[model samples]
Target: MKEAILAAIKAYDTIILHRHVRPDPDAYGSQMGLATIIQASFPEKQVFSVGNDEASLRFLGKVDEIADELYQDALVIVCDTANTARISDRRYTAGKMLIKIDHHPNDEPYGDLVWVDTSASSCSEMIVSFYETFQEELTLHEEAARLLYAGIVGDTGRFMYPSTTSETFRLTAKLVHFPFDRPALYRHLYEQSLPMTRLAGYILEHFQMEEGGAATVFLPEELLTRFEVDPREASGLVNVIDSAVGLKAWIMFIQEGDVIRARLRSKGPVINELAKEYGGGGHPLASGATIHTLEEMAEMKRKLIAICLETV
Candidate 1:
């Protein structure tokens, strides 16, 4: 599959990259990191990464605003996005060919050339492996290194998650060889604003725990308004209560417009199954779902509690 993707890259003169909507570090890291590599290696080819600009991730790199005609004959490659609905840009299908590179479950595979590696720590790690596989033909610079490293770190929780395998560390070791400011990257990725800090404090103070080891916190839009934080920014605090005693799994429900988004995390129980029941799916230990109403959110909490109890 890597050989096939490489051949596709070599065949195209104009290549466009994409990631998931409401982008995270991994999404930006993989999309732009691969773009940087291709642009550096093939200076003559027209390469662009298209997506909405995420303010928090602006430190990594900015996205491009190319003409729609660019996709007329372009090779579109999406990274870190699992399903079609989650893809940031709808123009991904306007290209001549489409490639999917992701680390999520291949539940809704939608590409001409799909490459899904759930075992890989992040899509950025897979990008590094791709570069390493054909180092002679590919060029990776400091910027690409920084982006890929950030993706791996974000998805792995700074190597704290179980997804961090021996290969993850081995590839990460290679990324550090480039001359990038690792400390600054850490600061940019983790430094929280005062409002976000207060929001985290609020979450830590108010999250509830069930007898079956299911922890949950619901952040209504009004509470977010009180904290002056965006719904996307509040999602970052899902792990604020992860270390709480007797917690087997946790869910952070943040209201975004009309739908309530659920960020689910578990230590042992399989929660992605629950996520799927509610129109979301991700890793077993980490997943997400959507709720339409407060009543639905309560029902999800009951199901998660049952799952945790079964695991125990």
Candidate 2:
């Protein structure tokens, strides 16, 4: 990991950070945390975090936007994303060197130097651990600490996921020293608006569970418009199905125009390989795919159900 970081810093005077599109707290956290570290450590170098506009996560931090003219000889560091297709910006490849740091199970390497560990709970955890190894020479600022904390908390479901380990807690302990309000962060995360709460209730009540405890929910785009909630507000719905009792696997398909966006998750046994089959990628426990029509997504879900039945 140090080799990759050092090589990137030495190769380019400017560093641009990127993560997956449709920004989540974890993606935003890792992006902000690493950019903060590089900027604070090497004051002479210019580091930028570029991706989507992130209208929802604006409170976390603002992403830097540099013109395309600045792309020459720049180093692009992509964090937390498993596939190049999911990366927020394809323009990142214009950089002289690409560096990837991720904790997802897939080994679809997209960078000159790749550091991927499936055992880690989140990519932010991997970044923090690697930084700690160089703690003697590097520093951790409050901005970096808070952002890292947000990633750790978000990805691990506040340490509820099976991937959480002793190292995760150890790193959490270290990050708290920077002095951020824990309660406020938790509130911003767990607290939802009344409309969102109502939407969630509707989703849960309408959810259907097949044999072998595989649950599924299909949300039409019209429902989102009716509730005045954006796509980001629907992010937690798949996770909610994942926590349902006796659910071996779950899927959430949202209809938007001609496309049907699907989020797949499983607790055990069943391997829902829908992501790779349908032009997306992520971990075994969590994956996503978007298809041209609901019929296509339904066929994919049917395949997943067949796999789950065979496993059972």
Candidate 3:
């Protein structure tokens, strides 16, 4: 599969990269990391990474603004996004060929060449592996290393999550050898604003822990307004209560416009099934879902509580 992807890259003169919507570190990491590598290695090719700019992740790299006509005869590669609906830009299909590289479950599987490795820590990790496969033909410099490193660290929770394997650490060790500033990258990826800090305090204080080891917090629009934090920013605090004792799993529900977004995390139980029931899916330990109403959110809580109970 890596050989085929490499062949595709070599064959195309114009390549466009994309990732999931409402981007995270991993999304930008894999998409732009691969782009940087290709751009450096093949200076003649027109490479572009397109998506709505994620403000918090701009420290790693900025996205390119390319004309839609560029997709003509272009090779489009999407990273970290599992399903077609979650892809950021609609122009992904406009290219001559479509490739999907992701670390999530391959349920939807909507590309001409699909490579989904759930065991991999993040899509960025897979990108590193791709470069390693063709080291002689590919170029991986400081910027590519920094972006891919950030993705692996973010998805693995700074190597705290269970997804981090021996290979993850080994590849991460290689990434750190680059000249990029690790301390600055860490600061950029994790630093919170004052309002976000206040919101975290509120979540820590008010989050409820159920008897079945299911912890939950509901951040309605009103509460978000009180803290003056954007709903998108509040998603970062989903793991604020992860260290709470006896917590088998946790869910953070943040109101976003007419829909409520649920970020689910687990220590043991598989919660992606629950996420799937609500029209969302991701890793078993970490998944996300959307709720249309407060009643639906309550039902989701009940279902999560039941899942935790079963695991216990």
Candidate 4:
């Protein structure tokens, strides 16, 4: 991974950084942080962060993107994306060299050198490893440090997620040395607006649980329109519902314009492989898919219920 990164840095005159679409904090953070580091270190080279916007991840930094014509001799660094389809831009393939850095359970290689470790809490953690390996030569500026720190905390649920480890903390401790207020970041992440709070309450009121303790919440198009929360804000609502009493697994059914988007989560042995069945995929513990209507979501819930019951 280090060699690939170093090679790409040295080989290409123009470096383009990209991440997943509808990006979570980690995805945007890693891209901004790594791009900042590269640009600061190698001022002679042209570095650009592409395919991200300021809407979803506005807290991190100014998101930058360049035109497709610029990818001719660019070395692309793809961060925090597991699958090719999830990559925000298809023009990444046009780069002179491709390097993928991710933390997902995939064996397939996406670029010249692929680093995929499911055990790492997030790609930002693995990027920290690279920073450490090149510590002698690299100095993480304040912007890079802040962005990386946000990625670490966001993806690890503030270090509460299971994937967090000694290495995660060690790297995080190193990152904190750079100046950024931790409290401010936390506030921006967890604090809720009035609309968001009301939306959460409404979703909570509609929660249901199966006989086997699998929780489910179905949000019809009307409710979503009434609340005005973007689909991004409603990203992992099922996981929130899973905190209900005796909950083992959970599902959130959201009605988009013409489709029902499903988010699934499992505690144990409750594999929601519905993502795989419906042309989407993620970890067994967390997955998602989109269906045509409420009836299709009900059918998927039935499948998930069967899986949860068998686990119990």
Best-first order by TM-score: 1, 3, 4, 2
Per-residue lDDT of model 3, residues 1-312, tens digit only: 999999999999999999999999999999999999999999999999999998888898889999989999999999999999999989999999999999898998888899999999999999999998899999999999999999999999999988999999988888989999999999999899999999999999999999699989999999999899989889999988888899999899999999999999999999999999999888899989998998998899999899989986
Q: Across residues 248-284, which tens digit of lDDT does each residue of candidate 4 receive? A: 8777888777887888877785454667788767776
Best first by lDDT, ranked: 1, 3, 2, 4
| Ranking 1 against 4 by lDDT, winner | 1
How well does model 1 score by local distance difference test? Answer: 0.95
Give the lDDT of residue 242 in candidate 1.
Answer: 86
Q: Write the per-residue lDDT of candidate 1 for residues 201-296, one digit (tens) a residue.
A: 999999999969999999999999999999988999999898888999999999999999999999999999999999898899999988899899
TM-score of each: 0.99, 0.93, 0.98, 0.94
Indicate the residue-level lDDT of 222 in model 2.
89
Model 3 clash tally?
0
Put down candidate 2 lDDT per residue, 1-312, tens digits, no spaces.
676586567567888999998878889989889888888888888889999877657768998878996778799899998878779977879988888888886658888888888898988898798779887756679889988999999999899878899999999889998778888888887777888888888888888888777677888888988987766568666776566777788788887677777888888744546677888667777778778886786787687777678766
Error of 2 at 129 (Å): 1.1
